[model samples]
Target: MMYKKLFLLSGLVLSLILVGCEFTKKTVNNVNLFTIEDDINLGLQVSQEIANDPKQFPILKEKGNEDVYRYIRKITNKILNSGKVVNRNNFKWQVKIIDDIETLNAFATPGGYIYVYTGLIKYLDSEDQLAGVMGHEIAHADQRHSTKQMTKSGALDLLLSAAIGEKEAVKQVVGGIVGLRFSRTHETEADEYSVRYLCGTDYNAAGAAGFFKKIGGAGSPPEFLSTHPNPDNRVQEIEARAKGMGCRGNSTNKTEYNRIKGLL
Candidate 1:
């Protein structure tokens, strides 16, 4: 009986090792093992929750809104067309501006839902600067950072469930604590991806560097700082990335910039 139990225990241990290796492999490929369909579903659910929350800024709607959307779409298309974004074909991209002037923040959800606050737009002096911010947020989606976070958290929950003899409840907890940790890592990697993508686009890569400069002295830290890298550290990283890519200094579009600035 003892020998039989040892053999069964060894088999279970080997099985877990194989399962762990598979999970790690999926995560390392820069791709989430979960399907885009599932990601979009989760994103839609979370987005609805955010929309329902009182704290989220209201979505903006105005006359000539399509024009603004079209212009931003053009810019997004340019970057997406440049082959810099990963899994470009897998998403339906949407950008929304919240009409909140007090909050300076932007973020991208899985399945390509991006939100930018008007306060952040006001801070950007040019279209390229705007692109720098948008690109960074979009990079988070392209990297599937959120989905990967969900996957990791899910795996951990499964392990915990099995340990507690509640394997059936694993899926219920998959999108828990582990997901939060992955989300943080995804934010940092997306920052790097943004720098790289900006280098190849018409957007002034140095605008990214200058962006940090503008935000650095802003009296109070904004909501963006909670999940984003420190502006000072981001500026240094942007400078170094731009230097490696041969992008130097600000290259503003005077005409487009003035037009956008006039609106603010």
Candidate 2:
């Protein structure tokens, strides 16, 4: 009888080990399953919902602002065509300017839809500064960080359900999980990608450091810092990375920059 009980315990332990291994494998595989196409589709769906919702910010379309749109398109296209992004072929990129002057922010939807607020543009001193901001937003899309966040949220919900032994509790778990902010690691990773993208392109990568410093000292957190690392820390990281790449201060894109600046 003792031997029989011992055998049963051994089998149970093996079963638990197998289950744990499978769960780990699933989580790792799901992380890799995120792709640019998936991100774009998710972004599009979210954007459409936001567009339909009256509470969301209105899409900007001032009569004389066509020039502003054209200027943004020209610069964005130049950066996109630079071939620095590893997954650039996967996106059908689009840029839109928000008319709101008080909101200094920019965000990228999963599908390559990027929105930049007029306030952000007004604060930018040069084209490279604008590119630096846009590049960081693009990096978030390229990395599919949102998808990973969503996946992790779902996984946590499942784990919570199992721990409580009640499927009905999953909704509460999910609600809390969704509200959980991303860790510092994700912000750092995005910053790294942004700098790398800028480095291989015509955009002055070193200018990114200055932009962060300006934003930090501008009496408000940087737009990029809204869902990212602290601006001060980000500036330091950018400065270190830029120095390593041999990029230095006050690089010029003055001609094209002035044209865009005039529109603002």
* Cα lDDT computed for each candidate against the true fold: 0.59, 0.60
> On residues 182-263, what C-alpha lDDT tens digit does candidate 2 reach at each position?
4355556667766776776667775556567776655545335643466788888876887687654344577777776666
Give residue 218's lDDT in candidate 2 (0 to 100): 57
Candidate 2 error regions (>4 Å):
1-35, 155-181, 217-223, 226-228, 247-251, 254-259
- Please state the error at residue 17 of candidate 1 in Å: 25
Question: Candidate 2 at residue 262, lDDT?
Answer: 68
* Best by the lDDT measure: 2
Judge candidate 1 against the unseen true structure and give its global Cα lDDT, from 0 to 1: 0.59
Q: Give the TM-score of each candidate.
A: 0.69, 0.71
Candidate 1 lDDT score at position 239:
73
- Estimate, for each residue in 1-264, the C-alpha lDDT of model 1 and write its tens digit: 433442343222322322222224434535445676755655555455445543454776646666566666776786676578876788777777777777677776666777777788777777776777777778767776655643433342333332243433322322221123333345456657776777777677756556667777566554234324667887787777778888643556767766654564
